[model samples]
Target chain A: MNTFLQLLNRVNSRVLFFGLLFVSLFLIVRNNEAQGKIFLNSAGRVTGFFGSGATAIGSYFNLRRENEKLQHEISVLRGQLAKDQYNTQVNIDTLQRVLDSTRIQIYKYIEATVVNNSVDKPKNYLTLNRGRHHGVKENMGVITADGVLGVVRYVSKYYCIVMSVLHTDSRVSAQIRGVDKGFYGSLVWRGKDPRFMQLIDIPKHNKISSKEDVVETTGFSTYYPPGVTIGKVFYHSIPPGSSNHLIQVKLNTNMANVRYAQIVVNVHADEINQLEARAKDEQ
Target chain B: MNSSSTLRISLKFIIIWILQIIVLKQVQFLPLGPYYYEAFVYPLFILLLPFGMHVNRLMLIAFFSGLLIDASYNTLGVHTASAVVLAFARPYILALVLPRGIDEAFTPSLGRLKFLPFLRYVIYAFLVYLPFYYTMVFFSHVFIVEIIVKSLLSFIVSVFFTLILAGILNGLD
Candidate 1:
């Protein structure tokens, strides 16, 4: 009788466990775009409040390094600004119309403080203090001063979630640092490492890349401006029965330490996407 | 139900919660390499609940505690699911580890269950919890490599820390 009781007890607990697990999975799956926004935003608000407090304390310890990073960025921007001013002085009359059409506010950056961030998950995300109220929108590209960060996934009144580049589903168009820019590939995280990601589907005929080869974001995507540093080629190998070289890359941004970032706003994205949608419809 | 037991459990929860978020959250598994796994001692709260606590009530508490932890960790539903599963597995794990006719009123701790049995219980409970948490986080079998590597590292580290915590709780008693 006792053995029978134990068996029934085991079966009862097993059923309870699975029933709850089913509900959890149901929550994950059903919490899609519209419904997920409500839950995520409400949760984000509470978390954001706490996270910001912790970040403020954390930021106090990091102020010196933060200042140095900003200073270095400012110096680089100063040099580029100087070159742009000189070029305009020399060629303004002839190139003014073209420059105004192509270069006038195509991409804008909205600065945001990282309230909360995680890198150790298969699907990592970051929560920023700036949100819809700050003109932050979903699908915008997030980048540090140094390297590619992620794309904005969801937005609330005063907060947003950026799906980090380390996410398994995150694929960014990236290219090797060379003249042959046409041979770019989609970079993806394999869920094992935050420090490394893989750029797959490079045709076998391309020369085996050296470890020194740098990788950067390509102009193929509306999310990021061209030439953002993504990572450097850490290693490469061709798996048997496949025609592409599996390129392992060492990510440039130390994701664990990123406390601030800029969101890329592509003014032309809607126009380009609408044009592409029309083409698809016609086909 | 009694004031002292209630106080002891509340104390356990507070100490474990702080140790988890403030201390262990900073403890990375491989500080230099891929940096995947994290040490989780918070689940020890669910593991060491009062032995007489009803399983349903335990699951409810586990779920809310997990939700609170998730609020801090930034991963919603994942830890909650793992904690509920841990709470469910606790009785079975206790049955497997404890000597027969042990008092139900007693909480399972290092002193009560003996060090080796309690260690085995932690291992067994983690075996249930980590796989569920990682699977839910990844949401795919393609990440088997990560799931295994992370689970193993988390189990080893969490068990070590939780055992120390269990010892401390026992000392308090």
Candidate 2:
């Protein structure tokens, strides 16, 4: 037992190092596939607690600009509401009221404050203050006033991590604005240039107008609503032997400075997904 | 260690941790172009721990502190692994730098090691820390060039900031 103790004592640090290293490696491997696990992701209580304190201090400096932006957003929303309002003329003493409850609401927005964000990495993520407790779920879309931000990839009680559009694997179905039934494509980030993204798979045969063409989400997927502006087309070129136009788009929302977002909750997502699954099984 | 000394060490950890997550993490030197990297002074917590502490205890301390930083950075195990490696390598590096063998109670600091030895110690520690960090971040041999290039760029800036921070917290000695 004394000799065994000597051996154990001799390699105690190495044993501990390898043991801890193994645990860390396990965390890295497990976390790579699913970022939603509460303990490993930033949405956990401990990380969120620290992130909130830091974000609070940082946001204090930008209050004026944030307020102005919110005010602008409110005005835009008000204009949209006015346009949708139906004006009815009353000829007699009968009162007319229009209840829009017949129109099923397909989308709901939950406002969230960004607790932590990073744009420099290959796979960037943003943490928001709202999470599972706030009706947030994995795969829901996140959007800013001007454009779409990302999809919620992980969630905990009071915080969640969004896989930002800046990530390499991020792909958003997008099309040119003002073009009904136009050819759509996928928007992808090339791991650089936070201000820009590449929209690919647009057929070369289609004519793209040069007048500051805007790109918007196609809403083909459950991730975003139809007609959400993504960016403006900056440049496009057709490579030799390729049948698609490589379009560069300048993003409207700056990924680095965005502090607030609204999570898009699709109420009919389950029905759509089930229908699609049945169709796939039939095929 | 006495209570006063323990309090001082705790204070150092708080200052360094805040400097790392709150200040340095947010300072993205965008002018550096694609080789973007954030400065890290939190490793100073492990480096500044009282000497003569067992390697087992030192590694454990480094592990926990790294987890704390990783929580804020959202990299999780990446920082923890790197910090542990640095902690394991630190004693050997210390022995190499100070060939004559030093006192057990002395904590490494700008004042304790003087200027030159202290600088060498910090450089060696970061050299181990940053490359391992970038490797874990990229996580594939396919990014070997990127790992090297990023490590070199980050090393220059991180070491500079760490020295400046060490100078400010010079009272630790």
Candidate 3:
């Protein structure tokens, strides 16, 4: 005990010195970001390099499980395709409507590895290995095999950052599957759990039930394609003073363990946005 | 200071940092419970700082270590701020809990202390560290109750791991 205390006293100054330096560095970095001078980009690259390396190691260990998951996904897709072919005669109008509404063609599924992900906070973001060189661009939608993940927020030459669906600032136009009209809701991660996200601004008039509803993207936002799965409603309640229902969605994608993902770059997103802007100008 | 000791300390820090960034961070013991509890290895850096190190210096190292972890994890400044705070409070916590005449220059070690004193140190460390860590992580939100609960839970789990690490390091030394 005496020796331990002696060591503690001796090292106290060193500890304090390092501690203060850290605090000052943190303050400088935080403050500098507000001034638009980011000194941490180099640090970010170093960290990113380490992160990507770690991710590679992790993926190596989980290869068997990932392979199984991919195989199952492939079979599921094949079954769905077969079923769709069979139902085409019975639902010609529905098929035509779906085809007409899908203006964007996803030419290829650009697989990117997630080097970093933040889901515990309000404004979560994800970093991917692919960027402009891989045909990935801003406004591209990202997803794992399970469901919708998020949209690309920033793109660099070889890497891209995605603002996750759990972000408070993430407003995706979505609705219950098969519902004609869509509603706008802000996705907010409650911080209690990562598997579930809270959807706000859903009108109280909409009929909702636990475990019975499927939420999908409305394609109103250029970031996601129509009918892409978002999550399933698990629980909902009307806040006391508001007319909107507070709905909790159990996300289909296990985001914490997501490894490989596809970034969907809609071919016609720019043209559609431009046309809409012109139409609004004429109006 | 001997060159060997400095080299050893630097090596330890580097090894721990790499293990934390590469191995421990990937260990997600998920589906275990409701909150997706995962082992966080960053606190081990704080626990392993040389005894008698200056509080400010310790904070700086802890902060940089945390910032590196945060940058890699894309958590921005949360880890850096919390780690600095944790390092700053360690000395005060030690003074408040440990008995007098415990030699001032002696670094903290489980092997050097009685069970009760060691337990007190562990508890104090958790109390000082957990709240700051969780607060920074959840800074944007105002859920005080959730914050307290999550912090406490994380503290309990992380403290266990820290104690084990401390024990192992002391045993090796």
Query: For every candidate structure, what is the RMSD over all alpha carbons to the true structure, in angstroms?
Result: 31.0, 30.8, 30.6
Task: Give the B-chain TM-score of model 3.
Answer: 0.82
* Model 3: per-residue Cα lDDT over A66-162, one tens digit each: 9999999997788678563322122223212333455634434577779899777877889988887677789888977777788898998778999
Report the lDDT tens digits of candidate 2 across residue range A1-283: 5574455447778888998787776666565544324224443456467776656767888999999999999977886896634222222211122338787778877777787999999999999887777678999999999898999999998788999999999999999987443789999999999999999999998878773899999999898998999899899999899999999999999999998898888888889999999999999
TM-score between predicted and true chain B, model 1:
0.94
**Best-matching candidate per DockQ:** 2
Would you estimate the TM-scores of all the predictions?
0.41, 0.43, 0.38
| Regions of candidate 2 where Cα sits further than 4 Å from its true position | A1-11, A32-283, B99-101
Sort order, TM-score high to low: 2, 1, 3
Which is the winner by lDDT between candidate 1 and candidate 2? Answer: 2
Q: In candidate 1, which residue ranges exceed 4 Å CA deviation?
A: A1-19, A27-283, B31-35
Tens-place lDDT digits, model 1, residues B78-165: 7888898889888888888888898888888889888788888989988988887887776666678888878887788888888888
- Model 3 lDDT per residue over B1-173, tens place: 34565575666667666766687677764433455444554665675566667665576577677777777666666667767777777878777777887775555667776657877877777777777666555442464665677777776667676676667667544
Superior by TM-score: candidate 1 or candidate 3: 1
Residue A273 CA displacement from its true place in model 1, Å: 69
Displacement of residue B106 (Cα, Å) in model 1 is 0.5
Q: In candidate 1 chain A, what residue range of length 10 has the lowest lDDT sum?
A: A86-95
Q: Between candidates 2 and 3, which one is better according to lDDT? A: 2
> lDDT score of model 2?
0.83
Per model, the share of native interface contacts recovered reads 0.24, 0.43, 0.18
